[model samples]
Target: MKELYFRAMDAIHNACLFVAGAFLVIIVLIIPYGVFTRYVLNSAASWPEPLAILLMIVISFLSAVVCYREYLHIGVGVLPAFLHKPAKSFLGWILEMLMVATNLFMFIWGIKLCQTTWHQAIPEFPIITVGLAYLPIPIGGGLTVLFVIERFLTQKFFSEPEPETISQLTTE
Candidate 1:
């Protein structure tokens, strides 16, 4: 069961990375197009800026999931550095529980937010609901919840779960 969960998490992490990267590429490509049309052609495009903003929201949320999974999210090192091994391990567990709690709040509230705004549509995108733009919040939060579960599972079965970068560094 744990192995299956770990495998699924690995796939989910990769998919999030790909989606975030694709959205970033789209933002990069379209911003210049918006600029060109505004400055060179003397007519500003209405859709590009709003679209880019929506894509950026998606990218930010999705990138956050990837960062959390990779252990690349920001952390205060000073306190942890002063602790002994066991204390540090306990602190790490405490921090992860906090992550779970925070993400749970995000997921619950995000759903309520989306439902509340579901009736509204963006002016530039009449077909897309305002809620759709905010969908990433819940999705990212839910995925992080799953990643946290994976981490807990991994820790139970394995000795420890090291960040990929650290493992690579130690190998070299």
Candidate 2:
């Protein structure tokens, strides 16, 4: 059961990473084109700016989910470092629960926001609804919730592998 869950999570993580990376590449290409069009051609393209903004939102949310899954998000560790083993354990539990609560709030409120804006169209891109632009928020929040559950389950049921030391890495 746990193996299946972990495999699913791995797939999700990779998908998020790929999406984020693709958007980043698009953004990189887009800004330069926007600049070139405005400066060299003396004509500013309207769609590029708005499109970049929308892509950025999606990239930010998806990247955030990937970061959380990989434990790459910024965290304050000084307080945890000072605590004893039992206290550290308790603190970790408290923090994880807090993260779960925060993600839940994001997911619930994001859906509401999307529904409220569902009828509104983007000014620059008439074909795309505002709701579609805001969809990444709830999606990311939901994915983070699943990842957090995976973390909880794996910690409870699985023995974590030991970290390799510098000497071990050097030998390999």
Candidate 3:
């Protein structure tokens, strides 16, 4: 089970990296094209600005999921640091639960928003509906929620007991 979880995490991490790399490629190509069209041809590509914005949004959200899975989200941890070990663990559990609930809420709301915009087309990209543009919100949020739940369960129940000191655990 632990191996399976690690495999799943690796898969998610790889997928996120791929998405980010693609976004970078798209931006690199689009910017040059946009610049050439504007400076040389005295015309701009109609799609570049909006497309770049969409790509940025997707990349940011995808990166956020990776961060969440790694417990890399920024927080002021002064309170947690001051607490005793048992209390700190309890607080961590509660914090994880709250994060899970919040992500779930975002997932549900994002899906509803996408559904509501399903029939509405973009002004410039008429073939692509607003729903498609906004679809990443729900999808990314869902992935984040899944990763958080997996981490919560593993930490709260499945993980091995912690050692009294970091040095003790690390020593050969």
Candidate 4:
């Protein structure tokens, strides 16, 4: 089960990285093209603005999944450090539960939002529907929830150590 979970996570991580890399490359190329066209050619790249926005959305969602998978999200550290082990564990559980709830909420709402926008096409990119554009939210949120659950299960059943803190990692 753990292996399966890790495999799935690895696949998702690689896929997201690839998508993010492509999106970034597109953005980089488009910006230079837009600049050159406007300055030298005296005309704008017709698709650059909309395409850049779309790429921004994709990059944000993919990077968010990467961050979640890596356990790099921002959080308060003082409370965890000051608490006893049991207290810290309990607090961590509560935090994870809250995160699960938030992810579930985003997943449900994101799907609904996408469904409602399914028929609507983006103004500049008419080839794709808004549903497709917005689909990443639910997908990324679902992945995040999965990773969180995996972490919870591993800690609960396997006694994995809590993630290290900055203070713990640095020597005085």
lDDT (0 to 1) per candidate: 0.82, 0.81, 0.76, 0.79
Q: For residues 88-118, could you state the per-residue lDDT of candidate 2 as single tens digits?
A: 7778778888889999998999999999998
Q: List residue ranges in candidate 1 displaced over 4 A.
A: 156-172
Model 2, residue pairs in steric clash? none
TM-score of each: 0.87, 0.86, 0.85, 0.86
Better of 2 and 4 by TM-score: 2
Candidate 2 accuracy as lDDT: 0.81
What is the model-wide C-alpha lDDT for candidate 4? 0.79
Q: Give per-residue CA lDDT, model 3, range 22-129, as digits (tens).
A: 897899899889889989999888888888888898988887886665554575578876888888788878877787788788889989999999999998789988
Tell me which of candidates 1 and 3 scores higher on TM-score: 1
Where is model 4 more than 4 Å wrong at Cα?
156-172
Instruction: Candidate 2: list runs displaced more than 4 Å.
Output: 156-172
Give the alpha carbon lDDT tens digit for every residue of 33-119 in model 4. Answer: 988998999987788978888889988988887766665566677777788888888888998888899989889999999999999
Query: On a 0 to 100 scale, what is the lDDT of residue 93 in model 2?
Result: 77
Ranking by TM-score: 1, 2, 4, 3
How large is the C-alpha RMSD of every model relative to the true structure?
A: 4.0, 5.0, 6.5, 5.0
Give the Cα error of residue 35 in candidate 4, in Å.
Answer: 1.6
Give model 1's TM-score versus the native structure: 0.87
Residue pairs in collision within model 4: none
Per-residue CA lDDT of model 1 for 1-172, tens digit only, reads 8788888988888888788778888999999999999999999999999999999999899888876777667767788778888887788788789889999999999999999999899999999999888899899999999988887765521132355522232233
